[model samples]
Target: MIKRSILAAGLATALFVAPAFADDRPPTPEERAQIEAVLAAEGFTSWDEIEWDDDGHWEVDDAVGPDGRQYDLKLDASFAIIARDPD
Candidate 1:
């Protein structure tokens, strides 16, 4: 019974936590176009990954900026740069 309870608790936690990491996949074609245009306008020449986060934001990883340095960027739903972190 103790083992079963532990298993159930773990499963419950996973179920609840999963939504926080939802939409882990890449953007659709139209979404990609918009994202790419925004990146280009912001002087991001290249990016390694783009994740549509559960909070309706875009998480761009390994983005090469205008200064030719890698950065991690967070963009809001409107594709406006919200935060930038050096990678």
Candidate 2:
């Protein structure tokens, strides 16, 4: 029935979109240390915020580098730096 189809479609949409709406959360202490180790290796002196995204990526909101410049960083699940945006 059309009603059943509509309900199924709604349920399917919710399942597909749930991850996209996942909360951005602070990294766990262990996760933070891992992320910090990566930052250190990349010459980032400090970071203001680090979030573990639902998409399996890490986001550094404000990372200060050795050169005293701030950068926004994106890292893959493996902790490899994938993108850097300087401000």
Candidate 3:
């Protein structure tokens, strides 16, 4: 039982600490392009600007659609599409 507890503690520590030293790299150029392409394909046209919000989220503004309707695209750190407007 003691051995199991020790092993569990070590595993938990490793799980918590490992991600701290992990890469903090930003998205690659290819990834950016892919994300842009996906947005464009979804009818977003004018990708005027992108900014990070205070909550550590990203907001892509001025994303106009083919029909000329503007939209706001929000994404998380992993570039995962979080929400869309004009639903």
Candidate 4:
């Protein structure tokens, strides 16, 4: 009974954690280039805190704008700028 219980708990944990790890991979070069273009247009001189999400999109946690401000942004799978929010 204890062994069965342990197995059930393990499976539950795996199910909960699996999706959280799914988007941890880095963006491909094409995606990176696409993001670069959008950022450049927006005057983003530098960026950081990038991550890939389940929709096959990438989002920047924050970026350094040419005007000396920071902001957040997102790009769709095609590298199109989907959203932006300045900090």
Q: Which one wins on lDDT?
A: 2
For model 3 the local lDDT of residue 78 reads 70
Candidate 4 lDDT, tens digit per residue, 6-81? Answer: 9999999999999878856676788677778888887889998677877767888778878788878878877777
- Model 3 error, position 77 (Å): 2.4
Question: In candidate 1, which residue pairs clash?
Answer: none
Q: Tens-digit lDDT track for model 2 on 44-77?
A: 9988889987777899988998899999999998
Candidates in order have lDDT scores of 0.89, 0.90, 0.72, 0.81
User: What is the Cα-based TM-score of model 1?
Assistant: 0.71
Find the 10 residues in a row with the least total lDDT in model 1.
Answer: 18-27
Which residue pairs does candidate 2 place in steric collision? none
Clashes of 1: 0
Comparing 2 with 4 on lDDT, the higher-scoring candidate is 2
Model 3 alpha-carbon drift over 4 Å, by segment: 1-31
Residue 74, model 4: lDDT of: 74
Candidate 4 error regions (>4 Å): 1-17
Candidate 3 C-alpha lDDT tens digits along 32-54: 67668777767776776675565
Sort by TM-score, top down from the best: 1, 2, 4, 3
- Give the winner by TM-score: 3 or 4: 4
Top candidate (TM-score):
1
For model 4, give the 10-residue run with minimal summed lDDT. 23-32
RMSD of each: 4.4, 3.8, 7.9, 3.0
In candidate 4, list every pair of residues with a backbone clash.
none
The estimated TM-scores of all candidates read 0.71, 0.71, 0.50, 0.65
Q: Given candidate 2, what's the lDDT at residue 63? A: 95
